[model samples]
Target: MGHTTSTSVSARGRSTVPLLLVALVWSTSAVMASAQAPTSLAPAGWDAGIKLSEARDRNPDPSIVEIDLTARLADVEVAPGKIVKAWTYDGGLPGPLIRAHVGDRVIVHFTNHLPQPTTIHWHGVRVPIEMDGVPDISQPEVKGGDIFTYDFIVRDAGLYWYHPHVMSAAQVGSGLYGALLVEDPADAVGVIDEITLVLSDIGFDSKGVLESADSGGPAGMVFGREGNYILVNGKVMPTLRARSGAPQRWRIVNAAKSRYFLLDLEGQPFYVIGADGGLQERPETTETLLITPGERADVIVTPRGSSGGTLTLRAQLYNRGYGSVEYRNVEDVLTIAFSDQPTLPVQTLPAVHRDIAAPKVAGATRVDVVLTLPPAGADGKSEFRVNGVPFWKAKPYMATVGETQLWTVKNESKFAHPFHLHGFFFLPLDEKLEPIHPMAWKDTLNVPIDGTIRFLVVFDERPGMWMFHCHILDHADGGLMGHVHLGPR
Candidate 1:
């Protein structure tokens, strides 16, 4: 997580709005361009040996169970004999992968080894409010020298993750994050080797020391604090070993604080089997996939036999504001070394389920939400507001229990917002109508630029105040967040 320092809004006056809107449009266009860029090698040498896992079974074979998440500073070897200071979990940048099946109970005895207090928020997991791990909101921050047990039952299964919710901008960028795979037992397991790719960006000097967050102001508020180095599973460049002619399942998550990743596997064809919520209506095959922060993509790639061959995963250059920022591609994210070894029987991917009972919204209540930017100040300082209010602990947004409500999210801001709702998943109902994807059930959804996103959501579970905000870390930190309170049971 990174942030631009906040400044007094009165300083800029009204002149900042046009520039802000232009910046937002520029950022949106940049993402589109980057998504289409070709794959290339990265500047840094790629690192290998990161592990992958399967989420079919709730009980993880002890071989892969129990990941110790401790914060410690270590030297990361980016180039030959060049090591940089990196704050990591379990000794790696993008910590170890934790996999489990839905309904399985998981107990992670987490120890806060960092210099300051921190708490891990399970990004998309549905657990008790007490176990949510939000500092001062759900639970207390885990202090250094203290240990806390994160015990919860996985309810919905798909691609999810965990990161420090306290001082997230600093802690997350310091490399305190990892992947969490929750398996849906009822769904058919897909054929192909399963892999988890935690995508992140790091801004560090030649010595590997990360850059500090920007001082908040107009530039920081609209442009976002971005990094220079792109990483996949903590490696500047990584390669994968696969048998020739093997189908692989890739679970990709955009863990970047502010940058959205447009991933392209040069010439290799793949299908997007799932999204942030879960699987899509059907697998949409394409050469590239775009994922924003707090979003996930479950894709399947079949590597044709090419012995000792390489597959380059490149981040296309995206144009953001007045001009485009180039992602110097050099090192391949991962190379697939094919062997002549006989491949195992391929598993068929699961079919999209459409019969899951969803509550009807026509008979439920409705709520209107407005996502906007605050009035600019004379100092060119800009602020974000949601529903005419900033983030406040006591004044949470609320809705009735057992009610299927229509949430009309109007984006008055120029930039696109990926709004996330905690606890309950929702289905997008078009501009005014609901078209729930066959496999769609997600806690996060992206809103279009200068557009409105309407979703019909049913709040039937236990009532509590859950978080709702843009996935963009800077925007979220700058008071673009609020909580939705479900009526008491």
Candidate 2:
């Protein structure tokens, strides 16, 4: 369940006042748990199984393992006598948590049990080119009842995720998603009482049935046909028990296809210890956090004097897009019941690494990417073009061996585009004229509406054609996507 928007006014100057008031009200609402009712878990005896595929982790302890992706129909008593179709992994929403060391290898023997073709993309994990799981780009789609194996090395240790890269909007929105945790061996920084939260919004018809796919319709493109149900760890109104005064780490990933989450912890101070790639410069504390789809955050919350009480996790409503669809004061996202126990000792947080800097754009080649919409009467077409040519055009976006390049991405539309590059992470030269977070090493960055984002991107790792595109599923499907080739890098 979500929260309601606040109606308080700030006493500060007009501009800052609205933001402050919103934050205060949002935070207060977020910390207040719902007293209405708890949803029932899926009943036993529902069975669905898929082969566990294999992949590798590149960061901490390099080893190999397997993962399974399958779904089942279950009776979930969300309301009295109500059951819904839940696309899941191992038959459970939120699936099973896949944890590994930094350098371990993950092999996912994925079998498609759904009626359509699907493939899993390990979000944020850098792996072999063939194992990246973008259908047609890396490997063929796993058809219904067909099996495919994905093997890759986990290059970075952080809070990451796995979801369908094929027909992502339909598959992920149906709940074929889960969290992946890669821990650092040497310094077990965030090992205490960790919790994983996969945040997503579900859309259902008046009869509670999920809407079918639309082949490039405006309704599908803009609002993403957002779901009426918001789930955390597969449960509506879920709660985790934590000891009072304990320093708890929450690994939060926004798995929604389009919705952006502005999480407010009800004035309770917490530090953002990690981002999509990994740990940040130091913990930055705040009351509210904004995370778009495909983004991950590892935050630390240290309870104050209020132990043996409940802490609510709520979502604050803001404008849905560039226009006026106000969505303020939503309901709860999750809740935590604190027990009366001594607070655990606070461990020393890792320092942000400045040594591994992004290549400066001064000595790099320049690449211009123009995101274009399909022309009129193109048969319900939504396709992206680079340099005025669709992806099918002959010439590839190629770079010389070991060359650093400046990528200037121009968003021609009014929607925010979270651009993602495969095989490498780049630093945003400027995000809205402000420098990004100090320890920001990212494979995905959100480009604001009608704005340009310049990134000093380097291609020094491998030689292959890699994809770069808006992480928004509908936008990407509609041709707001491209790929780059690293020649003998």
Candidate 3:
């Protein structure tokens, strides 16, 4: 086992703090065994007695793995002396970590116990039409005190997440998300240390209470709700110890409502090997990677030997055309300190998959998803719009199955919006509508604040209803969401 430590980190991104004081109510320890049993904080009604760390992630059963999650209210201490009332699964700030391997069956028995309705939408998974978890689109909302089952084969291996579909503005915005790591059975992670970080930000009022989803009034309405604190795996700027010469794989997920993390390493250079869909073809070594809301990045690095051996994962503060109002300095998300004593062996990686096929363009249809913002209303406030329509009243776009299409996503908003599409990954295109990477697949693409992004997508196999929207949960909740019907019809 290795040593673990934490400290009270300020939101101002100050790196120095008293070491004795740990973050929030959690203590310091290595990635240890599961708790002896469930705590009282577990949802009391159903069989919600499960530990946060014992959520079937390490199960090597090599078959169908089934689990239960009870969605209910719980209190999580985000920082020292700071508690936020949150909607959780099995009573935790970030819900259970769902783990599976490719070709395995994942059966999640979801039970909703909150006062209102909710549904667990697999954020990046291409599941069946009836199991996609979009209320009134793919499936109905799971009402309070109701139970629903999500059984799907782990087809693609990658980093993904799950959160609520109904009331996402409040449910996910407040805190109801978790990581879903689907490993590739043939190409496994190597001996090096691996960490899965669910990066998030939380907002609070002057009264030290958790801010409501609607707290951000007008400007926040147009732009997404921005939080103050940067959290990694539920802790504020926690410190992680890594061996001097070991490589590490950080599977990171940006689970915030609006915060865009322009991550950069202070000590070592990062090799971006995978994305929301899966591994990239060849590793792209870069100093910065932009991870927007609802996006995930699988980066590998060998920390130590640079910057005096003080490895830090910092975000280059990005306002995304929000002006100086939301401007803040760079945030230190996590610290990776070199250790004299070794822990785990360095992990090895297999051949990457970079040759994603391009959509056939000769006979492909051209679809326009032009994001448009309407004029300010009488109240001098503006609501988000997609194709000049909102989700509550928008008409569904129809596409044929087995058809290749060139999608033009023009972001006409004042602020940047990360667009995400369900059911399929698309290949990015250049200004000429030609393939950019020619081999990279992405389910989420960053549409610049007043710029446009093009993609070539092929609707293969599944004939289902899928939602495409701004991944910023608040923006999506504000009606920046739309749907598409894919069928032989």
Candidate 4:
């Protein structure tokens, strides 16, 4: 963060790593100088394209890492030749990556300079009640030119993110999200080349203008906002260099309003090691991994092939609940090039993370939740409902602290929705009401159309009201969001 902003830009003809990517670098020297801010080793006023090594150094001591961020309106290039107006954090496409250790203390100094009120919700982190950032529930909205400090202990280690809670659909859609990595102490060096890919679907208007909208129609209301362009770290077709036969860790996040990413690498199988909460006991191999909105997947891949062999990262396109399908050479987010350098050894992992027991709903209370869509209006606008009613500003249910509850969610809607619950992770149940991943933890999951999902969660986190909503930002903004109060019985 020392006024040195660098980016790895790989053009069509340029195969070598370029030193200076002037276009990707946004100058914050003036802002720092104007504010007379003090310098620190933490990632304050940093860029999104920070190198892996520099990023790791910024959080050498997680116990005292101070991540400074600000929200403001700016115009930046989202695509190669596309310039769009956006509300951004530190004037970057996606905000700077905040890295720390599991036991570290994360202090976020958030400043809002936008036209409206806003707050940063530390997505998926089990922070304190006050640090949750939900307006009127945890804390009031930080008004324009105002500042708020969110300090909390980093509980779990994994891929997570941060974005505004108020007007989340508009704010997050305008490019205000970024990734968070809390490292596990057991991970050894020479393990793998770790990288982060913040996947987003940037929506542009008919006249090529960026706006916070879900198309204002029945389909959008039902399906949430889906973008035409798929971007990885704010670029299209970015070349990601990987050593041949070397194990590399790819931490991927889907920070879109609605689009679900069905990820697959050509000729390479994904060895998923972790999910939204953290690393699994061992790697789970799969050809196709469905990463819904607000979910994360930590994958280890080794491209074993000749030099210059291109491994493209493609997302299979589907008309959610419809009939149409598209595949093969779709939007390419990352092009994995097997470099000529010698490959390193595969990474080593611990026996297992601390014992995370299965969700025991044997005698736990059962709660039934249903998802449905109200009939379309005259203008073809539909209202997405959770239980025959759009979400009002109130807690629908009061959860008992430290108590286990079995919740069954049925999707009677026309399309699939990524179900996300804040504050705690749950073990999803199978058709027979059994623990699916009794050990592995996840905060966000997808609920298929005309289907059902049941999970048992032990609400052991701090007593407070937490959000449970569709990860599709538009759906949440369109009154498909609610709060669950977790307090002492």
Give me the candidate number with maximum lDDT: 3
Q: RMSD of model 4, in Å? A: 11.7
Q: For each candidate, what is the lDDT?
A: 0.65, 0.63, 0.71, 0.70
- Residue 74 of candidate 2: its Cα lDDT? 41
Rank order (by lDDT, best first):
3, 4, 1, 2
If both were scored by TM-score, which would come out higher, candidate 3 or candidate 4? 3
lDDT of 4 by residue, 1-489 (tens): 121112211111111211133213211110111222222211222222323222223444525578678888777676556777777888776888888765567788889999999998888887877988889888999999999988987766678898889988778887888888876433322233567889987777655577546465556656576666777886666666666666566788999877788887875788776788776545577888789889999877766556667688888764555422533235576776666655545534212222345656688888888888777778766777877777874447878777888888888877777888987877777988876652457788888888898888888747888889988877777767777888886
Which portions of model 4 show Cα errors greater than 4 Å? 1-62, 187-190, 205-208, 212-214, 322-329, 341-354, 378-380, 393-395
Model 2 C-alpha RMSD to native: 12.6
Clashes of each: 38, 48, 7, 0
Error of 4 at 88 (Å): 1.0
Which candidate number would show the highest TM-score if scored against the true structure? 3
Using all chains and alpha carbons, the TM-scores for the candidates as numbered come to: 0.79, 0.78, 0.83, 0.83
**Comparing 2 and 3 by TM-score, which wins?**
3
Distance (Å) between predicted and true CA of 120, model 1?
A: 1.0
As a whole number from 0 to 100, the lDDT of residue 52 in candidate 1 is: 38
Cα lDDT of model 2 by residue, 247-317, tens digit: 56678888877777778878787678667866654568789887777888878776543556778888776
- Candidate 3 lDDT, 1-489, residue by residue in tens: 011112211111112222233233112211112322222211122111111243652334555668888899877776677777777788876787887755567888889999898888888886877778888876788998999999887666688899888877678777788888876422233423466888888776645567877875866767777677777776677767656556667788898878889988874577777788776655677878889988889887766543225578899867576752354687898776655454334434333434444566788788888787787789977778888788889988888877788889888877788899987878788898777752456788889878899887778677877889888877787778988889784
